[model samples]
Target: MIKAYSISLGALLLGLVLSLVFGSDLAFQRQWQLISGVEPEQFIDFAYLYSLLPRMTMALMVGASLGLVGSLMQQLTQNPLLSPLTMGTSSGAWLALVMLNLWVPLDIADLSAAAAMIGAMFAMFLVIAIVGIRNLSGLPVVLAGMAVNIVLGAVATAIILLNEQFASNLFIWGAGDLEQNDWFWPLWLAPRLLPAILIFLLAPRVLSLLKLGQQGAAARGLNVVPMFLLLSVVGVWLVAASITAVGVISFVGLISPNIARRVGARTTSNELWLSCIIGALLLVFTDLLANALSEQIGDVVHSGIAAALVGAPILIVLCQRQLRAQDQLSLSLPQSRLRWRNRYYGLAAFIIALIALLSLLGQHNAGSWSLAIPDAFNWLLRWPRWLTAVSAGAALAVAGCVLQRLSF
Candidate 1:
């Protein structure tokens, strides 16, 4: 535990320091002075004080909060396949913003944050309502979250398509950029996140009890229902505030706790704290990558995009064998006894290679599709997106296989 934390803390500090060093033209001495509250004499000084500092702070706060809540929920339900993202928070917040922009255009700017938080809370409760209090342990809660996400996402998309003009300003937020021109967002978000202290204070004991099984915990005189709801609402508040601060940065919350467990976070509190550190480390590096890649490629890659690009592959690598669980299913299907064949494997490989070849070389221009090698610039731009797509698709395919196999 000590070694794991020492390494994680060192890496996080290195990432933060590197981000500050490489992101600006100012010297480290001047940066230290700025941190010491010296008055700014140059634009870079002001940028360092305002833009860089607040952005990093936001990233850490949001990342830590997400990781904390994610671990909280996963431990609560004893289900590793859960996170705030999977609980419909993002979609709910998205739909609320869309509706606010449409129906309350005059107050949208002022009320957007509140609407998002409320929407997120509502979505969580809706999922709990679907699964019922007794059914929050496993796949039902996850499915409920998915159902809410699909419905809310579809509605939000439909509204945006119909009212594109009202939502014009939301395009950038939707992409999850963490660039801040001032400390206003950090200030706005900080107090709202104070409730996280409550989680830190209350959750470890409850979660430890929870690990003993619900019946056993009840035997120990823990009132599981009220404690569960209180903790859950607190978790939702933290997640919603993070989402409101940064638009829908997925994977940090989902992946951080999983990584923490892999790296020797044996205790509930240890997992929570380590995941928080890891989450912050991930977002800082991801944000740095987004900024650096944008400079290199002359395309603004948002933090969310960079996160997905990084997270999908890490998730598959870590959880490919771990995400599956044994569950009894009532439904049955006729089993097909098929023998594995080399020709089948060869044919599948051939099809995959053809698709990859086309994906790398195919271009649609002017009215028709043409097959040609991409130039260097296009290759740099396309490869990450393409590889991310492949990773995401493979992850989904694996999940589908798990679901199918788990059912019968």
Candidate 2:
């Protein structure tokens, strides 16, 4: 435990120093006199120093809060699948932004964070309702999240189609850019998050108790319902704030905890601290990559892709043959009741309908709609959007059903 704490503390301090050094260097480089012989303290002018200080503080607090939330979420859901993005909160936040844009026409630059928070909370509410207190699990929440995400994504797409002027801006934001001017974001997040962090710290044993099955927790005299709800609210708030500030960076919550566990943090407290360190390092490193690579690759490569880069290989390893074998032996699986009656015929009909739509609406932006239909159809099966959506939905549904059966 001491070793873990020391490692985490070391990483945290190191990240802070690097953040300050890099941030100051960038500010200095922007000016020629500072490049030559200006004092380092001159680079840290009142305005520059203030801006740098607040943003750095924001990053640390936000990262730590996000890490804590991820830890609690993984433990509560008992699945590594749950995360702010995967669980649909980020989509919900985007949906809110779309609605705000359509309805209010207020300055998005001013209201982005507020809109994000409301949207994230709304998404969390939907997930909680679908999973219910009795049926709560990582998988059901993920399915509900994906459904919300798809519907919201479709809506956002429609908005973009109608308002082409905003398309580029929305696209940029959607891809998870953490660059912001607000020195107040950390201040906004810190006060709200600090109470929960304190509660978590004081009740370390409670987290371990909660990690046990509901029955085990109850047997230990824990108030499972209220405590669970409280933790979820804190987790959601932490995620919402981070997403609001950083945009929808996928897999930070999902991958950080797993990495923490892999590094020898087994118990809840250890995992929580390690996750904070890992999450901070991840965001800093990814932000570095974003700054360094943006000139080469253009702005299309986002910080969120860092999670995929880091997490994808780890996910495969986590699902290796040995793990599968252990799961097969130790777990008695539930039979799946898939509703497959006229689905395939319906699917074929839909494909034909899509073809017809393409025939009618072809040639909007580019090539002949008629020619594009076949290409699109052929490509549809291989399309990342379609394939990921369907696979994620089906897998989450089955997993949810299985978990509900086993837990019940």
Candidate 3:
């Protein structure tokens, strides 16, 4: 526990130093003095004081809130895959804002929080309704969440596409920019996040009771529904507020608790606290990377995209390292008695290798295809496409095999 916490704190401190160095020319002492209440002498100092500091504070608060909420939800459902993203909060909030901007004449900037919170709550219920209250601790809920996200995300995307001019302001926010102009957002968000205290005080005990199993807890005279509902509502509120403040950053909540578990956080409270620290560290570094890349490429890079890029691979690796049998599938597949043969494997390998070879070397000119090694120019331009096709196909095939194996 000490080692895990030490690592988390070290990473956080390193991230803070890197964040300070990311886009600022100020020396470390000057930056420290500015943050320590020294007066800003120039625009650069003011930028660091307001923009970077508030942005960092927002990142920590939002990330910690997400981590705590995620831990709470996962413990409630006993489902590691549960998070605000999976529960349709992000998409739901996004869709509400989209519709608000589409119809309401008032500034969406002011109305976004209320709309998003409503949408997030509605989406959570929509998921719960689809899966049923009794079936929350299972794959059914996750599938239900996917269905909600797809439908709502599609609707929001279609609206944006159809009315691009009107919804232009929503694009950057949707990408989850952490850029701040001043302390307004930090001050606004800090008060809303105070309910996290309630979560910390109430969650561990309820979650511990829940660990006793629903039937066992009921037998012991515990009313599970009200407690569960309270936690779920608070969790949803935290997530909605988070995305509302920073747009649609995801995966932090989904991955943090898992990392906490991997690092040996056995108790609910320990997991929640550790996940909070890890989540804050993850976002601070991710934001630093985003800002660094923007400087290098001379174009803006949103923290949301950076989080997805970093977190997706980590999630995949986690999935592989811990491929346990989760909640049963809502639907069943037809059982097949047939077994794979060595010849079948050989045939599949040959076909994949042949296609990959041809894809790498084959060129089409004058409406004809021929297999020949491409020049450096062509290879450089097309390798990503080629790699993506070959790798994606193999990945899908492997995933299908794994799904079949796991399902059966």
Q: Give me the candidate number with maximum TM-score.
A: 3
Q: All models: lDDT?
A: 0.84, 0.67, 0.85
**Residues forming the 10-long window of minimal summed lDDT in candidate 2:** 321-330
Q: In candidate 2, what are the lDDT values of residues 1-408, reduced to their tens digit?
A: 677668767876777667656666554364345436555455345334456556566556655666667777777777676667656777888877876676677686677667877888888778778777554443455557778878877887788678877555777666776655646666666666666565467446777887778899899999987887777766776776676666667666767787788778888877877887777776666666665677676755666666557665765564452243434443455568876677799987898678555544454455433334436665554456555766797799999998868744
Q: What TM-score would every model get versus the actual structure?
A: 0.78, 0.69, 0.79
Model 1 pairs in collision? none
Give lDDT tens digits, candidate 1, residues 1-408.
Answer: 999999999999998999988889998998999999899998989998999999999888888888888899889988776788778887788788778878998996688778987898889888888878766665657668879988998898788778887676566776687989999999999999899889889889999999999999999999998999899888887877777777878778888898899899989999999988998988998999999999999989989889889876865564444434533331245468987788898999999999999999999999999999999999999899989999999999999889888846
Residue pairs with backbone atoms closer than 3 Å in model 3 (clashes) = none
What would you estimate as the lDDT of candidate 1? 0.84
* lDDT by residue (tens digit), candidate 3, 1-408: 989999998989888878877758899989889979999999999999889889999889888888888888889988888888878888999888888878884876788778888999899889988888877766657678879999998988898889998888778888888999999889888988887888889888888888999987777777898888888888878887888788888889989999899998999889989999988988898898888788789999999999988877876675455344554334567569998888898898898888788878888899999888889888898889988876898799999999878966
Off-target runs (Cα >4 Å) in candidate 3 are 105-110, 318-331, 334-408
Worst 10 residues of 1 by lDDT: 322-331
Order of quality (lDDT)? 3, 1, 2
Candidate 2 residues lying further than 4 Å off, grouped into runs, are: 20-55, 107-118, 128-147, 198-203, 298-301, 319-408
Candidate 1 residue 307 C-alpha distance from true site, Å: 1.2
Regarding TM-score, does 1 or 3 come out ahead?
A: 3
* Shift of residue 330 alpha carbon in model 2, Å: 15
